[model samples]
Target: MTSLTRAEIGALGEQLAVEHLRTLGLVVLDRNWRCRYGELDVIAADDATRTAVFVEVKTRTSDRFGGVQQAVTPDKVRRLRRLAGLWLAGQDKGWAAVRIDVIGVRIGRQRTPEITHLQAVV
Candidate 1:
């Protein structure tokens, strides 16, 4: 078995997150959206709720250092919240509600990837 690179792992995690969000009825508006401050991993819309969601994805091969979710620190959550505002400023239409979310992906040997989605993180 071969190990994936950091970029590859992150890409896989984001893709999986998008798929999972879509399954939950969210329409993906963008991925890897960047601004002068930082990047937003995923931006999606919950049509039913008229809400815009900003998602941060963290991928890890193991929990030796920390769990994938632990990677999203308070500072990171704050940054994501700011980035969400920046994203909205660039949008033509307004959303009824906005939220920040975190998606943790863990890939282990001989096992399917594990995904955890935490909404309204910030």
Candidate 2:
């Protein structure tokens, strides 16, 4: 089998995360939204709860670097919060709740990739 580049893996992970979110009924608002500070992997809305979800996707082939869960550090969460605020500020609509989420995608090991989503990381 051929190996995938880091960018390719990350893209696949984000796509999988989007699909997973859609299956859970969240409507995707934006993807790869970027600003000077940083980039937001996925932005989705939970219409039923009137909530906006900001997601950070981490893709990995193995757990050598402490796995995906350990990838989002406290500082990273702070940055994500700031980025989320920046994104929200540009919206004309309001949300009852806003949340930060982390989605971990692990591929190339099993027949199907594994996805782990942690919501409300704040």
Candidate 3:
């Protein structure tokens, strides 16, 4: 298969992440939600737990910089939190809890893309 562009890779990674979330029974509320502060890659709700999960997707062809786990720095987490808050502010529904999740999608290394999910990341 041909290599995908960076933005295409990102979009594919997010699509895979959404499928993963659905498999876990989370209802996808929004995707690519943006604000002046930043963008939220995925916004999902766990109705069973009454929680809102904000996901950040990082798609890489290689780990030259760092692994997916290492890609999210403290500063990035803070920014994601702020963006999540902005998204929540526009919602009429209330959630008992809010969480930040990171999903790393590694592609072109195998027959299928690899996904790693870190939930409730601080």
Candidate 4:
């Protein structure tokens, strides 16, 4: 059997994250939202609160070096911000109250899925 490629694995992780977020009451509005600078893995809404989320998903097979959240570098965050601006430009919606979140997912056998959510990413 062929092992999953990095992109494939990342996709799985993103899928899991979306499902998990849904379970927590976040309504997913978009996936793989992108622009010239970077991409946001997911965009979700809390309808009652009228808040939109720009999410960045990071996945890893292990924490041999560090967990998945460790991958979100300052540069990466900046790129996400840039892409988010471009994304918002196409919208009629206001983003002043929108939220940015980073989700870290680490996968391994026998370990419950590790998920960390960082809201208001900065």
Most accurate candidate by TM-score: 2
Query: Which prediction has more favorable lDDT, 2 or 3?
Result: 2
State every prediction's TM-score relative to the real structure.
Answer: 0.94, 0.98, 0.97, 0.86
The candidate 4 region of ten consecutive residues with least summed lDDT is 62-71
Q: Write the per-residue lDDT of candidate 1 for residues 9-101, one digit (tens) a residue.
A: 889988999999999999999999998999999999999989999998988787876875678889988888889999999889879999998
> What pairs collide in candidate 1?
none
Q: Which lDDT values do the candidates have, in the order given?
A: 0.89, 0.94, 0.93, 0.81
Per lDDT, the best of the predicted structures is 2
Candidate 4 regions with alpha-carbon error over 4 angstroms? 109-111
Off by over 4 Å in 1: none
Query: What is the alpha-carbon lDDT of model 1 when measured against the actual structure?
Result: 0.89
TM-score of 1: 0.94
Query: Where does model 2 exceed 4 Å of error?
Result: none
Candidate 4: tens digits of C-alpha lDDT, residues 1-122: 46889898899889989988898899998898766666779988877677878898888886775764677788888877778778778888764467778888877643676788888877
RMSD of 3: 0.8
RMSD of each: 1.2, 0.7, 0.8, 2.0
